[model samples]
Target: MARMRWSTSHTRPYTLRQRRRGRERIQALEQQVAELRAQLATQWVQAQPTPGTRLDTLLTLCSALLVTHDLPAILQLVVQQAKALFVGASGVLLFLSDTTGQMLELRATSAGTLPPMRVYPGQSTAGRAFLAPRAMLMAGPELALALDEQQPAQYAELSNLLTHWPPVSALLAPLRLESQRLGSLVIYGGSRAQPFVPRDLPFVQALADMVAIAIVDVEERNRTTQLASQLTQTQTNYAEIQARLDTAQAQLLQSAKLAAVGELAASVAHEINNPLYAARNSLYVVEQDLAADAPERAFIAVAQAELGRIARIITRMRDFYRPTRTELEPTCLNEVLRATIELVHTHLRHGHVTIQHELDAQLPQIVAHADQLRQVFLNLMLNACDAMPTGGVLTIRSTNEPGDASAASIVAIQISDTGSGIDPEHLPHIFEPFYTTKAQGTGLGLAISAHIINQHGGCIAVASTLGQGSTFTIHLPFTPPPTVVLSMYSTLS
Candidate 1:
C-alpha cells in the first residue's frame, strides 16, 4: 500500500499592513496635536462664551436650523477644529449614508477662497487620499502645476467657484457615527506648502467621528417629519369612510317606514273596493225607482247603502291587522313570475316600458311558501317597475338550478329591469334594512322579504350598474315547507 501524505493546518501569521497602518496613524495624530496645542492650551481658561456655546449649545444650535437635519452643523464644527489647528490650508467634510455604501456626500467646508468651480474630489493628490481614507503628503512631483491645470472639467469648474485663492496642499479624511459611515472632510494647503503627510490619519479619523454624529442627528429629523405626514393622511381617510357609513344607515331607516305604509294601504283598498261597487249599483237602482215616482223606496235604498259603506271600512281594518297565513304548495316558478308581473302590471302603466320573459320550460317544481313567495316576487317586480319611470324593458326569467345528491332541487327567479340603476355608492347598503332611493318609498319591503326568504333557507342577490339597469335574483331551495307542530292529547270514542 502507498504511504499517504497529510498536511497539518497552521494559523496564518498577522500581516505587516495592519501593523504599519497603526504606527503611521499614531504619528499623524501627534503632528496634528502639536499644531493645535499652542492655541487650544490657552482656551482652558474658560471665557464668557457666545450664545451658541452656552449649556446644551450644540443641541440648541442644531435644532434652530433645518439644514440636512442639522447634520452639516456637526460636520462644520469638526472641520472648524482642523482649520483652527492646521493653519496651513482649507478643509472639507463628506459623509457616507451607510457602511459599505457607494454614496459620498459633501457635508462641510473650511475657511478659504477655493480655486474654481469644479466637481468635488477632483483628481488631485488630496482627492486620492480622501477616496482612500489614508494619510498622504506631497512635496515633489505631486505638486506639478501642469497636472492641476488639466483637471476633470466638472471639478475644475467647482474649484473656480470655491475660491479666488487655491491651497497648495490639502488633507482629506472620512466621518463615521457608530456603525453608520457618514462622509469625509478635505483640507487643502493654505499657502504654497507641501500636501498633507502620512502621519495625519489619526487626527483625521477622530474628526471624522464627530462629523458622523451630526449626520445621525440630521437623519433623525428627516424621519420624524415623514412619520407625521403619514399619520395625518391615515386620519383623513378614516373620517371619510365613517361619514359614508352613517349616511347609508340613516337612509335605510327611512325606507322601512314607507314599505309598511304601502302594505297597509293595499289591504285597505282591496276591502273598500267591494263595498264601493255595491253602493254604486244601489244608487243606480234608486235612481230608477225615483224616476218611476217611488220616492219612499229610494230613501230606504239610500240608507242601506250608507250602512254598507261603514261595514266595508270596518272589514278593511280587520284584514289589515290580521296575520296572513301562507299556503305551502308545489308552485311552478313561471306561474309565480307571471303573478308577480300581473301584481305590478297596474303600477307599470307607462307606454314606453316593454315586458320580456325568458322562462325555462323544464324548470323543476318549487316546494315553497306560495303566498310569501308571491309577496316577495311582487315587491321585486314593483321595485323594478319603479326603476323604469320613463319606460324600459322589464325582463322576468326562471330556471332550474342544478342540485347535489340531496332530497330536493332548487330554482331561481330573476327579475331584471332596464331602469335607472342604483348609485354605486349605495350598492353596499342597498340590501340593508330600510335602504331605498324612492321618495315615497318605505325601504322596508325588501328588508322584510329578505328576512322571510332567509328563514326559508334562500338568498336574494342584486346586481346593478348606474344608468344601465338592475337585476335581483332570488334563490329558493327545494326544502319542504316547515309546518307548525302542536302537542295535544285527546280521547276518541
Candidate 2:
C-alpha cells in the first residue's frame, strides 16, 4: 500500500509539469497568430491606394490639363502619373493620328525609347479598347490572341516596341469624352509582385478622361487662334482696298476738272486774241503819229506799252490750255536748272531767301523738253520764294535712281523750302486750275507745272509739315513712254 501511494504522487507532479508546458505552448501559438494577422492587414493596406492619394493624383492630372497645351508633354505627364499610380507597372499613351483617323499612333510611354508603332482598329489591344465602352483588364491568352490577329508587319513593329518592357498583363481604358473617342491609355504589368486586376480599371479610366479633355481643349484653342489671325489679315486687306479706291476716285475727279478747264481757257483765249491784236496795232500807229517833243507823246508811248502787256497776258492763257508744241530732246537737266536759277536769283534774293543746290555730279541726261522743264522750275522756285517772304533756305536736290525689276532707271528732283507749310486742307487742291492761296496770285503756275510733268509720263508729289517746311518731289523717267509722246504730238498737230 505504501509503494502504490509513492508512485501516484510522483506521476501526478509529472502530469502537472506537462500541463504547464502545454499551456505555455498554447500562449506562444496565440502570439504567433496575432503577429500573422497584423502582417496580413499591413499587406492589404499597402496593396490598395488610399482615397486621399487617388484624389491627389486625379487633381494633379486636372491641373496639368488646365495649364499645359503641348500634346506630347501632356501625354508624357499622363503616362508618368499612371506608372506611379499602379505599382510595378509601365504605361503607354496612344492617340489617333492627325493624318489618318483609322490608325492609332503610340505617343508616349513610361518604358524608355521604342520604335514608332501604329495599330489598326479591331486589330490590336489599344485599338479594341478605343472602340470599347469601358475599361478592359487583359492577360495571358487574351493579350496573345490580340497580338496574333495583327498583320505581320504591324506585329513585327509592335513586337519590337514591346521588347523594351514585355508585358505579362495589360489594363486598357478608352480615352472618351461623351460621344468623342480620342484614343486609349494602357497600363502594362510585367513580372510585378502585385498584378493588375479589374479594380484598377476605374482609376485608369479617370486618367484617360483627363487626357481626352486636355487634347480637346488644346485643339479648340489652336483653332480659335488660327481663326483670329485670319480675321485680322482680312480686315487689313479690306482697309488697303478701300484706300486704293479713294485714291482712284480722287484722280478721276481731278482729270475731269482739268479737261473742263482746258476747254474753257482755249475758247476765252481765242475770243480775246483778235481784239487784242487790233488794239495793239492801233496803239502803235498812234504812237508813231505823235511828235517826239509833244506833251501827248509820252502818254501815247505808255498806251502802246499797256496794250503790249495785255497781249502777253492773253498769250500765256492760250499757252496754258494748249501747251506749245515742243519736241523732246536729250536735255542736260543741270544746264536748264542753272539757267532757271539765274533768271530767278534776283527774285529770290529780293525776298531774303538763300538757294542751295545738291545736284548729282554724275547725273545722266534724260529725254525731256528743255523749255517746258525751265518753265516748271521757274514756277516752283518763285513759289518757294513767295512762301519764305521773311528769309529762309531753298534746297534743290537731284538724284539718279538705279533701275530694278519693276521700274526703269529714273531721275528724282526735290525742291524744299523752309517756310510756313501749306495747310493740310489746301494741299489736295493746290494743283487745281485757278486755285491760289496768295491774294494777287494768278494761280496758274502749279497747275501748268503739274500738267507739263504729266504729259512727260512722270509724277509729282508734295509733303509738308505744319509749322515746319514743305518739299516738292518730281519723279521723271529717263525715257518718256511711247504712248505719251505720241499722244502729245497728236494733240499739238
Highest-scoring model, TM-score: 2
Q: What is the C-alpha lDDT of each candidate?
A: 0.59, 0.79
Model 2 alpha-carbon drift over 4 Å, by segment = 1-37, 97-100, 112-114, 156-168, 191-193, 276-324, 330-366, 391-414, 423-444, 463-465, 475-479, 491-493
**Number of clashing pairs per prediction, in order:** 44, 0
| Model 2, global lDDT | 0.79
The segments of candidate 1 whose C-alpha lies over 4 angstroms from its true place after superposition are 1-207, 214-331, 342-352, 365-367, 400-411, 423-439, 465-467, 477-493
- Residue 63 accuracy (lDDT) in model 2: 91
RMSD of each: 21.8, 7.4
How does candidate 1 score on lDDT? 0.59
Window of ten residues with lowest summed lDDT in model 1: 484-493
For candidate 2, write residues 1-493 as lDDT tens digits.
1111123355445578777776777777788889999998899778768767987989988997799998778888888788888765745646554444687877877655545667876657888888889888988889878767767876666555443345678888888889877888777776555678777888888888888899888888898989999999999999999999988887787767677667777788789889888887887787787777889877777877877756655654565656554567998888888888898999888899999999887889998888778878888988888888798999998899989999899899899999998999999889987789999986678988898788788988899987778999998999889977775555543
State the displacement of the C-alpha of residue 191, model 2, in Å, after optimal TM-score superposition.
4.5
